[model samples]
Target: MPKVTMNINGRARSTEVENRTLLSTALREKLHLTGTHIGCDTSQCGACVVHVNGKAVKSCAVFAVELDGATIDTIEGQAAPDGSLNVIQQAFKDHHGLQCGFCTPGMVMSAAALLKDNPKPNEAEIRDYLEGNICRCTGYQGIVNAIMAASGQAVPAIAAE
Candidate 1:
């Protein structure tokens, strides 16, 4: 076992984990930040996306030992200190972006990262950016609408048949 220390959600945490322990495991099992979901261990699903040093990375693909001294931000850190939902989260709720909610954390994380880099991305960019995150229930229209609304863009109307 190796001792790894890092800043998680503005708090410094030190834990001993196996050398091969994935960051996702350390976050969920050790640090108790289960909001960072693990959908596909193969990295095909972006459910475990989290910010490492300000860049979103799939936690399932990274070892906890490899991120020593790094600053990690999980879905738990996205809300305000007073517990208010962030803009992206609020948008998701308001736009009905989640159904089963299994993928909401990852979607919100990816959307937050996208909005952080490109505050006003177009519809195509939003879709392209979130291609890695798969949601079986929402069909992604609501997610896209939420991301668009979070960026302050006008959500395009879905025409009636």
Candidate 2:
């Protein structure tokens, strides 16, 4: 077992995990951060997306040992210290971006990454940036609208929001 140390959700966390332990497993089982979902182990689904050193990476595809001493930001860290939802999260709720809520964490994380790199993404840009994430419900209209709204852009009228 390898000792993995990371700054998780703004706190220092260390855990001993097997070499084969996926980052998603270390997050969920060891660190007790359940917001990062594991929709598919094959990495086709972006359900396990998280910020590794400030970039979105599919946690399921990476081993915990590989990210030792990294800075990890999970969905749990998206809220304010006062527990208020962040802009992306609030927009998701306001725009009805989630249905079953399974993909929301990843969606929110990905949207955050997209907005960080491109603050004002158009509908097409948002759609293109979200190609890695899949939402089985809401047809992605609300999701797109949420991202747009979060970026302070005007969402199309057909959007759910």
Which is the leading candidate under TM-score? Answer: 2
Residue 155 displacement in candidate 1 (angstroms): 0.7
Tens digits of lDDT, candidate 2, 67-112: 9899999999999999999999999999889989999999999999
Candidate 1 on 1-161: residue-level lDDT in tens? 89999999899999999989999999999988899999988998899999899998999999999999999988999899999999999999998889889999999999989989999999999999998898978459889999999999998799111
Q: Candidate 1, which segments miss by more than 4 Å at Cα? A: 159-161
Residue pairs with backbone atoms closer than 3 Å in model 2 (clashes): none
The TM-score obtained by model 1 is: 0.96
Give the range of the ten consecutive residues with the poorest summed lDDT in model 2. Answer: 152-161
Error of 1 at 132 (Å): 0.9
TM-score of model 2 vs. true structure: 0.96
Candidate 2 ranges beyond 4 A from true positions: 159-161
The total number of steric clashes, by the backbone 3 Å criterion, in model 2 comes to 0
Against the hidden true structure, what lDDT does model 2 obtain?
0.92
Q: If candidate 1 were superposed on the true structure by all CA atoms, what would the RMSD be?
A: 1.7
